[model samples]
Target: MHIAEGFLPPAHAVAWGVASAPFVVHGVRSLTREVREHPESTLLLGASGAFTFVLSALKLPSVTGSCSHPTGTGLGAILFRPPIMAVLGTITLLFQALLLAHGGLTTLGANVFSMAIVGPWAGYAVYKLLRRSNVPLMVTVFFAAFVADLSTYCVTSVQLALAFPDPGSGFLGALGKFGSIFAVTQIPLAVSEGLLTVLVMRLLVQSSKGELTRLGVLVAQKQARTGTETEAVGR
Candidate 1:
């Protein structure tokens, strides 16, 4: 959910911008390291960024007051890591803001914070945790993407609630109202995005195997498969 241009008060906008600056810097550094260490990863990184850009630009109807869309950073984060996702997400958001006028320059920091930094990292954490616990790959990816998409809207709702509190119930009440509206529309969309991300990952496993192999997904997936086969044989 984009907060739209000039919607936030000056203080909130500036504060968000200040808050996001460090993450953006670190993202740039992470991207630099990835390219430097695994030059072949450049293609995968670009492709991940493109995936984020395309999915994010498709803004759905606002079931509530604000428009909703898939952050798409979850897939990027899982593939390229959260630090790289911050850079890619910013670039995608900036592209839409400048070209399509979908979002806005004024609210870029807030959008990036939610879509790029917050959601992606949260999703990545979920993915890593699930992977460590021996979860199925598809299930892990589904939850990662699902959490990432939902978390972005959750953060956006909080941001909006903070700025525009309910006249009677104050921030807490506003938070509740905004969160409810978001949940209704965004829940289904989050599930859809999660499935789509896994589908895309499957496609990449075939079409972009080399690039993904460079990133260790192919090897990990192979190990998982072998382990499953061994367990079945023992059974």
Candidate 2:
């Protein structure tokens, strides 16, 4: 969900920007080093940014003052880590606000916090945890994308609720109201994103296997597959 320009109070907006700045700064340094060291990664970086823009640009009806869409940060977060994802997310949000008018400059910080910072980190964490647990490749990918999409809206809902609490029932009431809107639209969207990401990841594994391998998308799965084969051969 995108918080529109001027949707947040000036103080809140500024606070979010301040909070997001350090991460963005570190991300810039990391990305610069990465691109310099491995020129091939530029393509991967551009691809991730494009994926986020295309997915998030498709706005659904908003609840309160913000719009909803599936965030495509899962793969990027998994590949680039949270710091880099934060940088890419900021760029994506800024461009969408300027180019697509999908989001707004004033609310850029808040949007970044929800969609870029929180969503990517949470999704990446889930992917890593599930991988360590020996989850199947496709299932891990699906959950990572799905969780990332859902988490973006969840944070958006919280941001809205905090900013505009219900006068009668307080934050919880407003949170529920804001969150329900996301649940209705974002559920199917999350599922679709999960499936689409899985397909794209599989294709990447085939087409850009070098990059995907270098990025460590399915290393655990690969190792596990080899182990299974070794066991079967022994049998």
Candidate 3:
């Protein structure tokens, strides 16, 4: 749901620009800590990001002519952390704009806000929350990704309503339209995202034990001063 320039009035775009700026700055700072925490997973993150970029570009319609795609940041966040996904999110958006012209340059911040910040963090929170108990990994992943996708569309709808406030539109009116636009598309897409995330995580676990360990997913046997020990101490 990448918003094009001039889709909203000048006043609205400017307002969203203002609202989106802080998230971009917060996201940048958060990413640095993530890199420091999981130094060896750079390659994995990059690969995941490339997949995400491609996934997001695969457009399908939500409301007839109006199209949308999976953000994929939710999966990244669940596998790693939300902060690392933020970097992936920004890169995906930038590449989509520059390489594919899928989204506009001027509305880049708005895109970042909707897809990167909202999607990843929301999904991560849901995953972590659901995983607190003994819930099935697949089930948690499905719910987390579903909520994340739903959240992105909700945010997009809100921003659009703010930008293009109909003279007669109130909060309920906005909610109704937003619900109508996203409800159908998000459901199947969320299920797909969850399954894909689980499969990718499974692959990483099988292929590179070292990388997952470095990224802090696997907990190996404790040695007094090994990587695991050091990470535990750091934490």
Tens digit of lDDT per residue, candidate 1, span 69-159? 7878888888887988999989888888888787688899898889889999999999989987989877888999999999998998898
Candidate lDDT (C-alpha), each: 0.84, 0.83, 0.72
Report the C-alpha lDDT of model 3 over 121-222, residue by residue, as the tens digit: 899888878776758766777777777777887787777776655568676677668667775667667667777767777777789877766655565646
Query: By the lDDT metric, which is better: model 1 or model 2?
Result: 1
Structure candidate 2, residue pairs in collision: none
Question: What is candidate 3's CA lDDT for residue 28?
Answer: 72
**Which regions of candidate 2 deviate over 4 angstroms?**
60-67, 220-235
Model number with the top lDDT = 1
Worst 10 residues of 2 by lDDT: 226-235
Per-candidate clashes come to 0, 0, 0
State residue 38's C-alpha deviation in candidate 3, in Å: 4.6
* Candidate 1 Cα errors over 4 Å, as ranges: 61-67, 220-235
Candidate 2 to native Cα RMSD, angstroms: 5.5
Clashing pairs in 3: none
Better of 1 and 3 by lDDT: 1
